[model samples]
Target: MSVVDAWRPETAAGGFTRDDEDVAFYTRINALIHSDMVVVDLGAGRGSRYDEGSAPFRKSFFNLQGRVKQLIGVDVDPAVLEHPYLDEALVTEPGARLPLADQSVDMIISEWVLEHVEHPQEFGAEVQRVLKPGGWFCAITPNKWGYVGIANRIIPEKVKNALMRRVWPDRPDMDVFPTYYRLNTLARTRRMFGDGAWEHCSYSANGTPKYHGNRSFGFALVGLFQTFVPSLMRTNLFVFIRRTA
Candidate 1:
């Protein structure tokens, strides 16, 4: 079944989700926001840039407009300052410290972002510093062993950038960053986040292939891939953790 259809039932709590992971995630975020808590979205590119490839997931997030007391967007690319889903935007250097105060945020949402960080462990530290006690950080990232991630690690940056620009011409106009598979795998992610040893953590492999385009054959091919390949080889991974101290 398509991811969106899979998550249809749990839209009950608040917001929406295209997959099981996001259902649990948005449910938690919805509850926190009902309490007037603050949430930050990392790598929150403009909603306009959310292509057909990820539109369903993006729509679920967009559905959160008035539900949250406050939703903040932070990105290395200044163009994301225009994210419609965010109350405000903070643009900073790609691995620079977050502008938020320590322990000030109730939740962190990161979508298709962790793989691009130059220093994944440092990003973990920042997440630890900004999140309040019991605050959860939820992320969707590509698995390094997946076909897409292997291509990213193997391809030269300039060539890949050029290819992406050629294929998805709008990236240059919106926001595009390099991918470094540094924290893509479950083990690496766990070890890095272990730096803070946030009181609780969970990781789940999202059994979807990332190489698909908007075509049915593309979708079917990936569906076939997932059916035959091991779960670990699938493209998406979920990283959920909470700061309890």
Candidate 2:
């Protein structure tokens, strides 16, 4: 089954609510938006979750009616390409060679996807190959050093794999897909881009401590920690990189 067919939007799994936190977070990374740029959103999950009413996932696309030259949304799951804002959509395997032409795209954005990709180095290389000189790439993934990573390490591999299957039983076929942060560290990310291929702007996100049913106190506390020791927080990792010619 396709990834989309496996994971249906569970409103109970924290519905898509863009509060002050989301606005500020997205704004920082999307500040490089331009009208003439060919923007590509990778791993663009079911666009419905965020495109409610008219609010675009990237705040910069909010007022870009005629301004946007083209917007392409690509994902392994074909069901996620039904966004009104998308000029085109492509279904492709994750971590494999993207179907886009080399250096054809001006900007790329990905959210919560890198962690699930088994070969992130290849993925990063593909992003570098597809982006034009000076193009920007923004991505978000879970951090491996944060509290969640700690928890994952403590759990046995067998148990963790079982839990993942339970949480996403719909896609039992993809149960082998690596979950959680894998190749996501400041040093590792820099290396993936090669020597002087790109520059990092900022990397920050909230973390998760304990996952006790729906209680989010631990998650909230980790967010507070991000305010201070930003590097230590574990929930997510947001990165902005500009391609260098």
Candidate 3:
């Protein structure tokens, strides 16, 4: 089930469109790349999020474009373990202890993964544990209070839970992603890192389309409104943290 043996590049597989903000968001993250760094891509998806000829979960393969020395991808999904660029792939339950040695990783990157994790605190601790002292941990997750988040929240909790069930009925106990954003804001996200162990470098609210080629002015306005009214932008949050010993 290792990626090296299983991966097969497909030309028919489409890539992410430039219209989505994720293109810019990922590019910005790519700028931080250094050729010598050992990067771990957590929850690295199928690589369709970036481009063809690329693996989904390991953004460095598409984003850094070979600037990275080594890339490791970790996800619970067996399909993701088959990405071509993954130097190694480990399958583990989301938010459980990662199967990596202490202080072994120089940088860790995850996109849109926090919402899927059942216990973010444990996940954060795992990130801290695997990172070398002064290593970087970067992630993007939906802001629970943003426009999309508000729309989700205004629904009855029972309905929300039902929707989660309908989408991922296979894992009844798994929190169907984006669960914590409503309660975990920028301030709260900073707090979760605890004491001086971590520092938040940035926080921003942006639009994330559920569908391709479907950008709307109304949705853009909502994102803009959330900037001034932090209470409104509950849909997405991006953060960069440096782990300190």
Candidate 4:
């Protein structure tokens, strides 16, 4: 569920696009974080984040010890115990409540996780519950209105899982979950965060046809989606939020 961060254009022969604006957006958020911050990584896998992939919690600059007070990883799979980037890990039920105390987390980050949430409304409330007043939230998830998204919405889950297994066998099935895409659009984000009184720091659409290895149909569809469609139709959505007092 990772995309290339390189700034490749949608109109290029490679049929891929990159929205580096997300990197810049994250840079701003990174500057706001301090060494004493208590960060929670929602749905963080076994630290599979990489260069082409987003960094662990999408914060490469703060990866070292003492860079941040803590980075807690929460996942549905116990394999999260293998997460190297985490100071602590918590395994939870799929779509169940978070285990953290109320108003405890200073920051919350989700990398490609918002899409798979079974119930985003309740989940958003949970996020607000765990985050302290004035706390920050940032995330990267696929745009459900994008090219790959349209295809995914139409394709059956079983078919999609089969495709994923064939396309990305190295990635475990536990890493993949049913995508809801409830928070995929700009309007949807506004309704979710704005209604909760969360301050909107920034938001953007990022990435391109990196899915399916830039194959023919996906490449063509995503290229067109990146070019002709609006930003909401891009491959990924980058959102930054701040909880209000």
Better of 1 and 2 by lDDT: 1
Considering only N, C-alpha and C atoms within 3 Å, which residue pairs clash in candidate 4? Answer: none
Q: CA shift at 225, candidate 3, in angstroms?
A: 5.5
Per-candidate TM-score against the hidden true structure: 0.76, 0.71, 0.71, 0.78
The CA lDDT at 202 in model 1 is 54
Per-residue C-alpha lDDT of model 1 across residues 26-87, encoded as one tens digit per residue:
55555545547687888887765455555465466545556666788898888777676678
Q: Please tell me which predicted candidate would have the highest TM-score against the true structure.
A: 4
Of the two candidates 2 and 4, the one with more favorable TM-score, higher being better, is: 4
Model 3: runs farther than 4 Å from truth? 1-20, 50-61, 154-183, 208-234
Q: Which stretches of candidate 2 lie over 4 Å from their true place?
A: 1-21, 51-67, 153-177, 207-212, 216-230
| C-alpha lDDT score of every prediction, in listed order | 0.70, 0.64, 0.64, 0.72
Error of 4 at 180 (Å): 1.6
Candidate 3 accuracy as TM-score: 0.71
Candidate 2, residue 122: lDDT = 82
Model 4 collision count: 0
How many backbone clashes are present in model 3? 16
Off by over 4 Å in 1: 1-33, 49-61, 157-173, 207-210, 213-216
Model 1 TM-score?
Answer: 0.76
Q: Write the per-residue lDDT of candidate 3 for residues 1-245, one digit (tens) a residue.
A: 22211221221244333234465556666777788888998887655444554445435435553777888888887756666667777888755788888998888888777665667677777888899988888877767666556656577878867764553344435324445442246776687786788867857656533311123543345445645674445456777888887
